[model samples]
Structures are given as C-alpha cells and as structure tokens.
Target: MDTQTLKHLNEAQREALEVAEASRETEWTSPSFVAELFMGKIRTNLIFPYPEQSPEDRQIGDEFMKQLESFLKCNLDPDEVDRTGILPPEIIEGLTRLGCWGMKIPKEYGGLGLSQINYNRAIALVASYCGSTAVWLSAHQSIGVPQPLKLFGTAEQKKKYFPKFAQGAISAFALTEPDVGSDPAKMTCVAVPSADRKTWTINGTKLWCTNGLIADVLVVMAQTPSKIVHGKEKKQITAFIVEKGTPGIQYPHRCDFMGIRAIQNGVIEFKNVVVPAENILWGEGLGLKLALITLNTGRLTLPAACGGMSKQALRISRLWGKEREQWGAPIAQHEAGAVKLSHMAANVFAMEAMTYYASALVDRGGSDIRLEAAMAKLFCSEAAWKIIDDLVQLRGGRGFETASSLRQRGEKGYAVERMMRDSRINRIIEGTTEIQHLFIAREALDYHMKLVGAFINSQSSFSEKWKSFWKCAFFYPKWYLGLWCSFDWMKSYAGYRPLSSEIRFVGKNSKKLSRTIFHLLLKFGPKLESHQMVLARVVEIGTELFAMACSCSKAISLIRNNPSDLSPVELAKIFCKQSQIRIQHYYDALKKNTDPEDRTLSKKVMNQAFSWMEQGIIPDDGAGFQKNSETTVPLEEKRRYSV
Candidate 1:
C-alpha cells in the first residue's frame, strides 16, 4: 500500500512528500530536541528555554481574559444551562458580542487575529467556565469553515465568507459519518458533479456534527468520483463550504451526549444539496489534506480545555483537602489524599507546559507541529481524566451530586461530576486515545520507515541497495554510539542555561529512549505495526520525555525570571522526576513484558475460549443488579444524615 502510494506521486506531490520526510529527518539532525523527540530520536539541543510571550501579546491576552471573565459572570450560568441541556440564545449572542467567533480569524477579515497562544488562552478561559461555550467557539473557528477558508480559500471566497464569520456567524465541521470516524477512506457520502461542471450536488448524513443544529455555515467532506492516478483508479474526497438553509439541507435529529450538553450537535443531512463550483476548498481531491491540516491545529483546543479542567480540579481539590476534615484533621493531611493532590498539581503543571509549548510552536510557524499537537491532545486528555477523577475522589459524596442539587441544598457546590463527564469526551473527540497512539507511533517511526522503504523498493538498482545498506550501517552504529558515549557532552548541548541535576538525568534517559526505539525498529522492521502494544509503549515513552522536557524548561524559565519564587521550580522538578520514572518503566516494559501473553489471552477470550468460566453462570439479563434491600433512602434523607 505504501509502495503504491509512493509510486503515484507527481513531482510536486513527491516534493511535498520529501519535504515532510526531510522535516522529520531534520528533527534528529537539527538542534530542536523536542522536534526530534517526536520522531523517537532524542538529540540534545537548545530547543527549550520555554517560549516567552511578547509584552504586546501578553497585554492582549490579559485584556481578553478580563473581558471574558466579566462576560461569563454576567451572561452565563453553566449549571442552569447544563440542566436545560442548551446554551441560551442570549449567551451565544453575548459570546458573539465579545468577539469569540472572530478570535482566530485574521484582522483583515474584521476579526481579532489573535496569535495561536492567545487563541488557546482564550479557549482555556472560556472552557474553564463553560464546556458548551468553548465547544461552540472552537467548532466555529478551529476546524469549521473559517479555518479552511483562511488556509485554502481563494481571495474572493474569503471576501464573501470572512465578513459573516466575523459578524458571529456560526460554522461547523462535518467530517465524521455513522460509519466513519478516524478513517475517511470509509466515507460513503457522495458529491456528484453536474454535467456542465458548474455545480455539485452533495448527499450525505454527518453524525455528531458539533454546532450542526445552530451553524450558519458548514465545511463538509464527501467522496467525489474517483480520479485516475498513474493509470489506476483512486478515491477522491472533496471539501465544500455549504451554507445553512441550502436546498435539501436538513438537521434530522439533535444528538445528546454524556457531556458538553449545551452544544447543538446533531445529524446533518444534505440531500441533493447543490453547491457552486467556487465552493470547493483548495481543489478537487484535496479534502483529506485539508481535513488533516485543519485538525493539526484544531486538536489544540482539546488540550487547552484539558488544561482548564485541570486548573479547576486543582483549585477545588486544594480547597476541599484543606477544609474537609477526616479523623479530627484536614483530609489533605492524610498521606493518600496529599499524594493525589500533589499528583494533580504536577500533572496540571505538565499539561500547561505541553499545551503552551505546542501553541507557541504553532505561533512560531516555521516548523511542522503535527506530532506535538497530537501528543499534547493525547497526554493532556488522559491527564485531565485522571486529575478530574482524583478531584471526584477527594470530594467524595459532594463530587457525585450535581452542582444545582447541592446549591439547592444550600451547600457550596463543585461541578466535579459535570467536569468528569466533560473530560471523558475529550478522549473520544478530535481523535480517540487509541487512534492518537497509532498516529504517534506511525510518525515516530518515520526515519525507520524511510530506511526500510529504500531496501524494499523493487525499482532500486543493486548499486542503490548497496548504498542504502552502507547508509544504514553507518547510521545505526553512529546513532547508538552517540547515545552511549555522548553523555559527558550532552549537557553542553542541552539548550540555554544549565539544567538541574534531575533534569539532566531526564536528558540522559531520553537518549537511552531513542536508542531503544531504534533497536525496536530494526528488530521489528515492517511487521512492527502489528505489535500495537509495543508501539503504544514507545509512544508513551516519547510523550513522557517530551512532557518532562517542557516542564523542566518552563520551570527553569520561571525560576530565572522570578528567582524569589521557587515553588514552580519545585513542582516542575517533581513532575519531571515522576515522568522520568514513567519513561523508565515504559522502556523496561518494552524490553521485558508479558504483552505477548496478554495479547494471546485477549485473543482467546474474544474467540470464546473462556466459555468454561461462564458455564455455570447465568448471562446477565437486560435488567441490572438490584440492591440487597428493596427500600432505598430518599436523597433528602440521605443528605440530611450523610457525613
């Protein structure tokens, strides 16, 4: 499949492919350790003194945060909206008035034209207050019509759409279908071109289209007729900007979820919906690329939301841990509870570091950040889930109750339940955690794939094969030797000011990680993808390494700028120490683990070989298990007597 894909590329397309390949290669050869880390290659470099926000940018962020705070306080009641399962029209209007819709659009389009960091900050601020509002805002600009239009729309198209988008017109991204989630290759939606080629009629149903019910515009992807590529028929997907209320466009049903209830998500159907030729984005057959590019940055929103949720959890946990007493003292005094709080704080610090670093990379704009963005989304979402769960455990009974219910009972309420529900969706949306692991693993093995590709190509001459062999011979030994022997000089290349001993230890292990990855790639070759467990562990190691690097760099920057405050530095050190331990565990598991036996057991179970275990047990009926006692205490009575 890869061979065929590579064979059909034209010069320009091949150049683009080469550019991507070269960029991945540069990560290892260049001085950016973070970039190299994404490729599973750890080279010491000055990649992180932590990016600093310009004063002007800082001021803009401060002003926006201030305005957003006032706006949320005055116009939004998250608890009320959560109960109603709808965002009030007035709140949407308020967001529009606050320029939330235009936050990502450029200034020339009558929008805020905020930098990526500022944009993410804005998302975090709004998300902290209301998940639904954040979804609405992010859906509008992050992956919606505006983003693709900004990236690929013609000047005329921009002129036509930018103004409306700036004026608070809601937009949605419609890519997922009932059958399609991560794989667009399975898309069944069709866009048939008119005989004259002046228009195209789209017919499809998009499932879980966020903001679909309320969107004024939607960017939809559909399978166009196949185009011949190098004499072989190939599937072609196209993206179109379809205006709302277009002929045959209908919202057949509104979808509800476990979380983010205020979002106007639904199934959107386009039956014979005619879109003009000019509506096509970039060009025909570029839909997949456009979608991927949109998502590269679009995924950042999830991490920002994760960061926000973490902050909220940390604050709530700290207060509850101090105030809530157990055994004649604050629960926080207990070792178990104190450990959870510490982990929460450390993970939040790491999450913030990673999210901001990725955002800064986007704002910097010279390098490709597809890997960084995915890692951020993957790590932050999982971290936020664990952190929120800890918060729930910390609050005990109060965390299980809805905020409104607690408020009605005259107790200070925390939205831990709601936040937990909200955090779960982040793992599934944008990309599932499983999907992200696969994506990260694929990317991390780019160099190995290229090397293997050279050897496998049937078209390569004997001389070329010999050269490739020599290249590998030179590269592998040098790479491994560098990792082993370069420890003495690694610190000099460790970017900016000297790192603390703990951080230096992290750097040393990162080199070991890269060497281990290289050995795995050599051992597995093309069959490595089948070993999903090992691939997943490799991704885990890389993610932790990157997180540790970001945390340490951020701490160093904070300490340098504010020497008087060492608390942040300490937190960062703790996070890095924990990350280092995790990295070692993952690497060790990769070397010696029961994953193969686990896979065997899983396969046997799935194949129904465990029937003997269930032989005497009756299958569970549709009805769930009942309590031993028939009578259940009323909520009022329980609340009256519960601790």
Candidate 2:
C-alpha cells in the first residue's frame, strides 16, 4: 500500500498506486471531485460562487480585448488563410507585438503575466477571428515549451527561455509519436546518456507535433535507461529542451489536416541529438508528470477556443435565421430554427460559464483541477460542435459553400463549412472525447480504486488489510447514509441562500449524482473499470452537474452585482433545464440501458468476425484496405458515386 511495497507489484500496478497516492495528496488541498466523486461526495467549494477576476485585471483585460479586436480585424483573414493553409508573417508579427505568446509568462520574465481567465479570454477572442491563428498562438503557449518550462524548469532554464518566449519565439511540446497517441507509456522514443553523463543523445520521431516545423524551442519526451529503484529496474521518461537548430533535429515532412490548416504541424525526427545535462526538465522519470501537469491549465485553451467558436456560430446563426425567410416569415420565428438558436445561445453561455470558472480555479492557484479542466474541454468541444452544426443547418446551402465561393458568387461570405471542419479537431485534439471520459472515470474512481487496491493487495500485511477493510466499511455506510438522509453539509459552499430555483436544482442533483455513483460502486465493486459504458454515464452526469453549478453560480453572481439584469438568470435556467434532462437520461442509461449486447457486437465486429460483409469488394482486404489500380472505376462514375 505504501511506496516501499510498490516493488512487489508490476509496472502498471506500481504506476497506478503512485498516481492514486499523488492524487490523494493533491485532493487534501485542492479537494477536486476527481477522487471524492467515487466516495459519494461533492466538494462544492471547488465549483460554487464561481470565480471572479480583480478589478485591476478586468481593466487590463478590457484594454487588451480592444487592442486585440482592432488588430485581428485589421490583420487576419480567415478565408485567405484557410485557402493558403498558412498564417501571413505580418499577422504573426502583429500578434507577437501584441504580446500574445508571452501572456502567461511572468512580467519579470518580460511577459504580460495575465491571469488564466484573461489569457483564456484572449484565446477565445483570437479563435473567433481565425482558427489557424488561434492554433498558432495556443500551440506557442498552451502545451508548448513555454508552459512545461515555466512549470518544471529550473531557474536557469527559465532565465534562458523566458525572454525568447516573450519576444514571440514559437515553442512546441513534442510527446506524441506515430505509435503513441493517448498512452505515453508505450512511447518508443529513447534518450541515452553519454559515458561522461554530460549530455543525453535523443533519438525518436514525433508525429502530429503542433508547431514542430516552426518552433524555436521544443520540449521532447523520450525514454531513458531503466534505473534500479528499490531493487526494481523502472523505465525512465525524461523531458529535454531541444533548440530549433540542434544538429540532428529534422522536420522530415509537414502534416496537412482537415482543419486548423495554418498550424505549422508535422513530424519531427531526433537523431542522436545531444542535449546538455542541465536541459533535462525536473530530472529523470518525471516527463509524463510534467506533461500532464502542464496540460492541467493548457487544457483550458481548447474550451475557451470552443467557446469563441460557439459564440461565432451563434452570431452567424442568429443573422441567418433572422434574415433568411421561410414560407410566411423569417426562420427565427419557426420553432425548429428557434430551438437551434436558443440551444446555441444557451450552450455558449454554459461554455463561457464552465471555461471561465475553470480558468478562475487555475488563477486561484490551489485546486487540482484535472477533472474540471477535462470536463470543460470535453463539454465545450462537443457543445461547440453541435452549435456549429446547428449554424450550418440554419444557413442551409450557404453553409456548405466555401466562403470564397459565396463571395465570388455575390452572396454573403461566411465560413460555416470551415468552422465545422475546424471545430471537429477540438474534440480530437488535446484529448479525444472518449479519452477524456476514460480519464475522468479513472480520476473519479481513484479513491475507490486505492481502497480496493489496499484491501486486495497480496503484498499488504494482515494489519494493513484489516485497516483498509475497516476504513472502507465505515466510509461506505456513512457515505450512503449521508446521501440517503440528504445531508446539507455542502450548503456553505453554495453561499448566501434564498438561492435561485436553478441553483437549488443543481444543489439537489449533486446529491443524487453522488448517491447514484455510490450505488453503482456497490453493484460493481472492483470490476467497475470494465463497465466503461456505466463509467461514461457517470462522468457525463458529473459533467452536467458541474456545468449547472457553474452556470447557476455565475448567474447568481451577476444578479447579486447588477440586480436589474435578469438575462444571466434566465440563461442559467435554460441551461440547467437542459442539463437536468441530460442527467436523467444518463442516470436512466446507467440503471437500465447500458447496451451491453451492442458493445459485445461492436467488439466482435472490430475483431473481424464480420469480414465476410466485404467479401465481394476486395479479396483478403480488411478495413481501410483499398483496391489496386487494376480494379478501377471511370473517373466520372467515381465522381458520381464518391461520398
């Protein structure tokens, strides 16, 4: 159960235990629902009353936004960039002059030192103007070398890199490879120390590395030799800073994407690249930890960007809905269009609520927001996607047409199609939707996992087992009883009451969610991880609850400050109503509609049991298999039939 006993376990088991222990320690101060959710508790302090920026910061942000608006409007062209697949140098120069790259870096380091909320707001504004520009700026700071270096780099490292970052030098974080996507443990990149140990020779290929081609500095992760730790040889993953002109670093090929086309992304190859010993970030075996920790706040960029996308979609949809008429009146008057418009606006409000709330937590600088960040990214990305889709639906044929095509044809130029394409990547990048669900589930179940792990660990002594068993026994009963009895312990976190009905609804469901999780744990016990379908539902419910809490809290804050304006309150009600329905749907699915048979069938199909279905199409061909040139169709016919 302790670190010393970890040697008796396998690598995966040891890692899991270490992670759980680290998370437990983090929760003591941060008190995130990531661990507490499994224990049937809502740490309301983490989410309620929302977060607010200082007046000084707000004033700075206002000025920054005005400057940003003028700069973006005067400089960037979304349509031109989408066509050219590159951002103009002048625009990058302009952004650099505006200090976009150094927004998060400390002022002492020659950067603006904006709070997380303001930084996020900046990203949202930049993203609204151009997705390509957003990616360029975000990649430079969000997960780029600046972030990891700022978080884990030594004082000397900061001194060396901060000024360059502030001057708009592009930086990138290279961790992904052709074979490694979500699982960094499976990374094949290797870093071997020289005999003198003065330098490390890194050899690896990184794929889909954002800004890989254009970055001045790169934070690269590679496997070092396994070190003997307490009689066990543990593989070490270390992070190193490799400068742009490093002798053996090469950008072999640029990668083209379906969207965010202006990103200078590609494959980066490291061939015996020598990095000085001082370049290793946070020492050996901590690369993954650094990457994750860096991403904690870096993840906020996507949600903020998504919020901007949603806002833009809402704007365009509104215009199209009002100006475009149907049989008797404008489409805005039609129930179908009205529903999409309302949902789009409501979702944008919810996204802003969630994004800023999470950003505020980051700015507050104490909470372990791993769960909150993931939830915001997941929810906002998917919501933005839906909102953009709705925008397209509202725009009709014009939505599908290229902005340039529309312009040339003397129609309104709108990037609805481009926006849809760009928005799709938000769900896929940083972490996929499915990946986020699994991650949230893992963190949410950490407490339970640790308890069960302790009880069942064969390496544990009899005393430890009994201790764990007793703890679990007492905890479960009390937790269930507390839920069933409708404990009001979290009321303080909700703040001054005579709470809005929407806020009350969120508070009520938080308990219901906790109770549902408890029952689910009781039913599944240690085998709960295998029930991913159920876990996904649980995560979804928690996401909705958090979103509701955020929306209601923000509304309440607005109402308290401005008493006359009720728009925030109304919007919160709409969002909460939608979230309430979603929570019920997920709760119902958890109880009765898990679709196990469908899952089993899907697994079977994945394993190729249904290969015969494509028998006549191509012999011995599997999925993704294509026919040779000998089996060809006419160009016209291909054009006619191609999807």
Candidate 3:
C-alpha cells in the first residue's frame, strides 16, 4: 500500500494512487490526537483541554445565530422549498442582507470574518432547520471558491474574488465529471496554455456541480501539462478561478437528487473557455493539494451540520417518546424505547464534542486536524442518520408521513421522514463513509508505512530494504515491548471524577488497538491493505476510542463548570460504556470474522453467480437510461439558457 504500488496495479489504479499520494499533506507540523491513538499512544494532552472556543467568538456566533434562526423561522418555508425544488429568490435575498454570504470571508474584504467555530455554528443552525438552505450556503463557502481562495489564492486572486463573495456572489467547486467521482487522476478535463502563454483554454464538463446553475463564480480543477519527476511522468492538476459569464460556460442540464432538492445544482460544460494565467491558485501542479487541504479543513462543516441535525432529531424523539403511548404505557417507559432514547441523547452529546473540538482546532491553528475532522465527519454522519431513523420509528406511522401530509391528516408533523432523507447525504458527500474509512486507515498507518513499509515491500530496492529494515528493527521492537506495559499507574485522570475509569479505558484499549495493528501488519505483510474488513474494524475501534475520549473530556469540562448539574457526566458515562461494548466487539471480531467468506461471495456476485436469484423480479430492460447530454450544444441555444 505504499503510495504507488507498481507491483501489480494497472495503469489507471497506479496513476490514481500516485496522484492521491502526491496530494496528501505529508508534513507533521503538530500532534494529532486521533493519529497518535492509532499508533498506540493516547495523546491525552491534546484531548484533555477540550479546545474551548473563546467567549468573544462564542458571543459572535450566538448573536448571528439568533438573527439567522429568527429570519429562517419567519421567512423560510422548508416544506415549500422542498416541494417546488426551488429556494425562493426572496429567501436568498434575505440571507444576503443578513450577510450570510460573507460568514466565512474576512472583514478586511467586507465580510463577517467569523471564526471557524462560529461559521460551523451557523451551518449547524441552518442544517437543523433546512437541509436545502444549508447546502445553498455551505456549497457557496465550504468547498467553493471562497474556501480555496482563502487557503491558496494569490494576493491578486484574493483581491478580485473576496469582495465578490462579500457582495453575495455565489460560488462552486467543479472537480467531479460525469464519469469521475473520487478519482481525479483519470480526469479528462484539459487546460492548455496559449501560444503567448498568457492564458489557458479549458474544455471539459463538470457534473453534480452544486450551485452551478446560479453561481457567480467557480473554482474549476483541470489537468494541465505533465511534469517529469525522477524519470516518471507526473500528472499536474491546476485550480483556476473561472467567472460565470466566461464565454464558453454552459449549464447543459440540471441535476435532481433524492434529497436537498432545492439546491440549484447541475451539469456545467466548458468549451474552449479561456482564463488568464493569474487565476492559477497556489501555482501550477498544486490543484489537488489545494483541494485536499481545502477539504481537510472544509470537511469539518458536515460534521457540525450532522451534530445540529441530530440535536433536532433528539428534540423530536424526546417529545414523541413522552407523548406517544403503546404497550400499556408511554413509549419512553418501555425498555426498548428507553435504550434508544438514552443512546440518542448520548450520541448527540458525543457528536457535539467531536465536531466543536475539531472546529476549535481549526481556529486555534498549528494543529493537524486531518484525522480528527475525518473521524468526526465519518462518525457524526452515520450517528446522525441513526438518530433520525430512531426518531422516525419512535413516531411510528406519523414519522413516515411528510410534515405537510401529517398536518393535512390532523397530526403533529415534525418532518421526521424528511430529516431521514436529508441526513443520508452527509455520509455520501465530502467523502463517502467507505472512502473516509480508507482515508483514515491510510493516514493512521502513514507513520508505520514510512518507518518499515519498504522492508516488506517486494518492489523495494536493496538499499531501500536495508534502510527500512534498520528503521523497523529500531522502532517496532521497542514499540511492541512498551505496549504490554501499563502507563495508567503513572498517569491520573484527576478532574474526570465519575468517568475517570472510562478515560483510562481509552488509554488502555489504545494500546490494544496498536498491538492489533502491529500484528495485522505482520500477518498480512504488504497485502494488509487489501483486507478492507480488517482495516474497517480497526478504524471503527480507533474511532469509538476517540469518541470516548472526547465525550469524557467534554462532559468533565461541562460538569466542573456547572457543579450543580451532573447530567453531563451521566450522558458521557452512558456514551462511553456503550462505546466500550462496541469497541470490544470490533476488537473481538478482528480475530474472528467471516471476511474471507464475504470476499468469496462478493467475487461470485460480481461475476453474476446469483443472476438466477432475480427470476421473480420485474422484468424490464433499462430503456429509459441515458448518458448525460454532451457538451456540444449550439451557441444560440446555450446563450438562451440562464445562468
């Protein structure tokens, strides 16, 4: 699993792997809590303080959220937005007047200049109320031009774009093509420089471009000329600031999806679109790196978004649990209902701690939050969906009904079903859950791979092997020996009163996780990366362990400050105990699982071994299926289309 495994990878995979590895932020400028936990070291200091947002920043968020909440409640009708598949122009105008457009931009640029925490809080609030509205804003800032501009824009680039964003100009990031989702190496979009070398002519089509239908500007990623490095040809992806009215830009089609339907998303086609060389962000050959780093921090939004949505779900569930009656009593009193309610509360608490902690790290600066942010996104999205699902179940048939329908039928319509649909896309956007797991696994094992991977890799040169062998010999033995020794006796969880032992459990099991990883590395050697199930289990254990630490730290911090209330401690304790059970189950499954059988069955299924099982199903061919319309529309027709 080294960056480019040349041994057996085909051209496409090898290139994809190489491009992705090249894009990774390879420096370790600061300690990462999740990164160390995977290495068998619980960097307690990183998580212990809990990274609180400053009072000044919190106040800013509070005031803005107050205004936003009020405006949304009074003016925005989410059900209508969903039903029409259109966010009203008046609602957008209201948001603009509130300066929602500039929430992430700088004050120097005529923007709000809210801290990361505050920006996240705004997103969370928006998401809690309206998923479509949240995307409308988040897409414009999160991975859109404003984000990359803030991160990698040149001074000139910033001067031109920042004010536009401040003036309520919407923006989008265009990276996905019709055939490409996560794999950018296979990207066919090309930007070729002109004879004068002053501008580049780009030709490509971008798919699923959120806000593309109405965005004022876009950050488009396209492959530039290749560069030869160390006797190998390397792909170079360059980011450019492409204005909406650029001559050849076309909105060929609009995209409708299962959720977030009000978002003005669609397919964007570029035909010989020319742009000045000054638009190149962070220089040529750094577009993917820019995207990755932008996403590294930008990805924090969804986690906060998930946390907020889950909070709403919790509220809806609690009311239903108390009011809904069945089985001779209120549902909340039933054993099964009680467990679900408690877990929902606990999980929501953990989600808050996880999301804010990561956002706080972004605001604090000098902290490596790549792992933390991804874990938060991975955990919160999945957790929020479950929370919303449980809300639906608790509401029984009422949950499945649309809020409008419920109102029509004379029932309380809380939008439980809508929430479920909205909650699902979080797991898929930013990155899919499976991709996040693999991304985390790759990063979690980065240190190990750097230290000893060459020693076991068949493709390593003799000298490389010699170097890595020495590195391995000097590192793993001492690391392995230390794992068996308990460091708990030397450390004390002083402020963690009722949950001190749970905090210690995180420390202890971290060692076990590290040992398990080391053993897996030994058993599978270079092929361990192929063992997706094993790595998934290992990642899950590490994630829950991380969750336990965050929950404990946050709960202790809360209870200490509010000594009169111990409910925070109670919630943390419940979450940690449940996390403990899950962690141990994953730990046990590592040694005993049906992964081999699962893989066997998967291959057979892919080979259509079970085609006969489809005999009883509806028997129609996919007659309606069609590829996206091509990018060759005539100029007259294209010009008639509105942006």
Strongest candidate by TM-score: 3
| lDDT at 274, model 2 | 93
Comparison by TM-score, 1 against 3, better one: 3
- In order of appearance, the predictions have TM-scores of 0.89, 0.91, 0.95
lDDT of 1 by residue, 82-159 (tens): 778989989888888878899988989888889989989988987887888888888888999988998899999999
Better of 2 and 3 by TM-score: 3
Q: Which ten residues in a row have the lowest lDDT in candidate 1?
A: 17-26
Compose the digit string of candidate 3's lDDT tens values, residues 36-105: 8988888888988778888888899999999999999999998888889989999999998999999999
> Where does the lowest 10-residue lDDT sum fall in candidate 3?
1-10
Ranking according to TM-score, highest score first: 3, 2, 1
State the displacement of the C-alpha of residue 210, model 3, in Å, after optimal TM-score superposition.
0.7
Pick the lDDT winner: 3
Ranking by lDDT: 3, 2, 1
Q: Please report the TM-score between candidate 3 and the true structure.
A: 0.95
Residue 312 lDDT (model 3)? 94
- Residue pairs with clashing backbones, model 2: none
What's the CA error at residue 109 for candidate 1, in Å? 1.2
- What does candidate 2's lDDT look like per residue over 570-631, in tens digits? 88888888888998899888879837898989999999999888677636435576766777
